[model samples]
Target chain A: MVFNYPNGKKYIPAAKIEAAPKIKKQKNAAYSNRGMTLEEDLNDSNSFYLDRNIAVIHKKPTPVQIVNVDYPRRSAAVIKEAYFKQASTTDYNGVYKGKYIDFEAKETKFSTSFPLKNFHEHQIVHMKAVLEQGGICFVILRFSTEEEIYLLEASYLLSFWERMISGGRKSITKEEVIECGHKIPLGFHPRIDYIKVIDYLYKLS
Target chain B: MVFNYPNGKKYIPAAKIEAAPKIKKQKNAAYSNRGMTLEEDLNDSNSFYLDRNIAVIHKKPTPVQIVNVDYPRRSAAVIKEAYFKQASTTDYNGVYKGKYIDFEAKETKFSTSFPLKNFHEHQIVHMKAVLEQGGICFVILRFSTEEEIYLLEASYLLSFWERMISGGRKSITKEEVIECGHKIPLGFHPRIDYIKVIDYLYKLS
Candidate 1:
């Protein structure tokens, strides 16, 4: 099952779109940037870091399978038919002060809990492999209703995912997330200022 | 101008495609995999490294700007109209054992020299930033005719690019490339074992 979230153009299975208990069509739109504020903020923050020569992280481009293309005589070729391809890795990754950092930014409208279905099975696997390879991996979770964001390590998220796999709660309560994740304060210059959290957690600086 | 080489589709400016003194559309067809063997090879090699728990490198997906989409009921969303966007960064980048690894792979069929036009000005600027941030930056240059691949440090490529801006030679002679870069031997499992070259260059081992 492909969880297409790139460019905010989701091609998710109908059942997976609102896996949360009380999610509605309008609730998803209430969040900033069509529920992708975390991504945009991270992009702004990464650009800030790159400009300052602090980090070199970038979001991977939206993956698409090109089916047909029309080459105009003297203009750019247009992709006529294409489908979103399933991403095999986490969305954001790069090197920070000689350390490998990888993570995914996810925003949820749920007030009390972050739905586990927001993540895919393959992403869990990818996160595990990244950690095994000694890469720093995590997820930037934004709870829109709470106006809170957290940088939760992949290992913690993976364990919660495993619990759900063996028929546990389908979501993690916000309290539990707060217990494990580093709260990211919003800023003006870098916007999210996630690198500060990374420096603190990884002791890079 | 955007060089659309991700899917073996050419969206190059007409003049830039045949920048070499002696080139035609027929000549581009001579290279393997529709002149995208280098990208394919690197992907294969990256997978090998990931599976072996060695490195966490990945090629960024081809960037596309989606203009229109059709979300059918209970069916996958289809991208109806899209266009290739100019890539701001080099194609491949990831973390390798605590080092940021970034690179662009270009295959040139010209026997005498590797054309500098295979690169872009922004890419040169990006390579410089990556270097300043202490990242491992380079280009994987494959001379299709010589059956040789070289990992030339981005510093060298950047110098050559600057010279081109001041009306120097538009290409780096094959002899100069051999002298400055490390020749990567083709391997069976990883296809192109570029990490070995990086390991030696950075003294990682």
Candidate 2:
């Protein structure tokens, strides 16, 4: 079961099993076959960047509320009871080349369109705040079907989200994303060469 | 009972009163009278700075491992079983004046000295990593006695920590802290005007 908060994105319970067979099949079908999930891949890429002194972006630790703990002798403390807490901002943010970099990463199987509903209202609000502060804000979208990645600026995202609210476009078409975003070519040393895109944006800004 | 991991910081279980009374009292005494803890004050200050476009800094969310979650109708998802996860980096980090700023805040009640025990080995390693990447890393120490605050650079901390391992000094002397650290003058608008100290360091660097 997934929990939907008013301001934030939906929370998919990591441990919950769906009762509906159709939905379960869909969820299973959506899972990537890259050996690691998108989060893990990003984390690995961040580590790679950090190791090479390319950039210092990091995924924020998962928020949790603690209730009980056990202190066992000669071992690490064991957490007895805790709960997941809703995050107030994006998953990844850091500094690079004296610029504040903020971004959210999402993966989609759709070859032709990316859903706007994947983003939360609070996230949009946060991106707006970052933009206002002169920070570089963007999103990394991975189209698994085509094995293509794109970096779309927060400004474009804001416009799309606003349009969605006014009953305009429900999702951003692949063609529009291709035109608006910089295609991020995957590389070996650092699998996701996002800094190159940042460099490109830096020059434009 | 507090949990102590093999390679992680020790966590004291606040709910386990019967475990150790003296330690509990000490911890409580350290935080007792402060209207807002250092972290809370810094968070408020960060929000103020971000709103004004003066600076950008944020505290990373607390790490939590979710085990089980229950999705009940019409309410926030309840996390049934979860565990606290050790953080891999500092609590607060961001960009200011094109410099990467990273730090950990700690409070001690001792009037004469701040115990080395308050700092963990992992934190030292993490600070070293930040420093190697050309980022500014420091610790904010709150001496509860005289309500004084100090921003001690990671270089100074690493030197002191090394000395402690060699049995030189168990804790940093209050006099040494005052001499080495940049004294942060408190203010009304931002409360803790740490950026002033950052400015000093920036000039020196």
Candidate 3:
């Protein structure tokens, strides 16, 4: 059967059925076969934490600017028009054991260096503000090539940002990150397990 | 001489011209100057807090889903089609004095009672999650007629919400709010001095 989308695009179900097995095989051939993206994994981890009453961290929804809507029925309102808007804050924030935790997640394909452009100016400003208010702020950096991760504190990020502005370094080197940040081991159940890092940081602080 | 809008409507100048004093008096009488709405006042107060670095709170931008946008030459992007979307989180949150503060601001025109319908199930759920995570969560209630404002903690709101579900009070009475919530005195510097209430709650907790 064929299903037509709102944009008049023809969708074929039989073709998708035929491709599903091959797509699954290809996906298994890829790294780890974790069956999820970084976003999905983190979301699941957050849910696990919430269920256990360990912490309450949430990924903020994408901001969109809406201009029109149509209500065909009394109960259903369909969005007819909208556009993505720039987010003014970090992606994730919540309270963990009486301390505020705020952070952004980023993934990089490069094994040697992560590009600085992945972080926006507003995110930097937000991190700085959180730090000034004595909240624990950090960024979770994932090197997809190496399948490794690190949690870099916002203070270190601010220093790198200032250095970039002063023409010192265009981006933070992998060595520098390894030296300054905490290495987070990949886990089976919660995936990132960043709360462990938070615990460590809290104890250290 | 006259200027017309794109819709061919007569344009009214915001500035007052040197007309006859009698005509000016008549024009002033025609318009009811009720001053700023509660939302506007709160927005101004939030901006004041932001400027002073006392708090980092912001009203989440109206959610929108855009279908079309026009980028005119030498002009900003014009959203041609969009629709408002349901927000999954509360309207306002920030870090204040080493604490994570989250809240929703609501206004009621009713003099005697505040309607429970003003809040959504999703908002209540979100507030509950934040509260469970040890974040300071609350709601700001503004009574337009009385020009009174109250800051009610999430615990109180949840209690009232439970009563609503159990066939108890359908709405919170004005007197109940005045008794249970902290009365935020309108001030000159930051306007809504909610931090005072936060300090008190912090101490109690």
Q: Which candidate gets the maximum DockQ versus the true structure?
A: 1
B146 in model 1: Cα distance from truth in Å? 1.8
Please give, for residues B1-205, the per-residue lDDT of candidate 3 as tens digits.
Answer: 0111222122323332122123223332312144444445566677777667777776666554343455554224444544345666688777887677888988777889888888988789888888877789999998766677899998999899999999998899988898899999877666687877888878832
lDDT of candidate 1 over A44-130, digit per residue (tens):
798899888898888888787666566665345666766667787789987777677899988788889999988888789888887
User: Which candidate has the top score in TM-score?
Assistant: 1
Q: Write the residue-wise lDDT of candidate 1 on B1-205 in tens digits.
A: 1123333322334564343212223344545444445666788899899888888788888887665566674336566766677677899987677678899998888898999989987788888888887788999999887778899999999888878889999999899899999999978888899999998999987
How do the predictions measure up, each by TM-score? 0.84, 0.77, 0.76
- TM-score between model 1 and native: 0.84
Q: Which consecutive 10 residues in model 2 chain B have the weakest lDDT in total?
A: B1-10
- Report residue B160 deviation for candidate 3 (angstroms): 1.5
- Total backbone clashes of candidate 3, pairs 3 or more residues apart or in separate chains: 15
Q: Measured with DockQ on alpha carbons, how good is candidate 2?
A: 0.23
When sorted by DockQ, best at the front, the candidate numbers are 1, 2, 3
Sorting all predicted structures by TM-score, with the top scorer first, yields: 1, 2, 3
Estimate, for each residue in A1-205, the C-alpha lDDT of model 3 and write its tens digit: 1111222122324554343233223332334465566666687788788778888777765565433345677534444433345677888887776677889988777788777888988789888878888889999988877888899998998899899889877778899889989898988878789999888878832
The residue-by-residue lDDT of candidate 2 on A86-169, one tens digit each, is 556788987665567789988788999989877878788778877775678899998877778899999999999989999898
What TM-score does the first chain of candidate 1 have?
0.84
lDDT (Cα, tens digit) per residue for candidate 2, span B1-205: 2221222222435564234323333554655575455666787788788778666787887665554555564334444544445566789987665567789988788889988888878778778877776777899998877788899998999999999999798999999899899888766678787877887778832
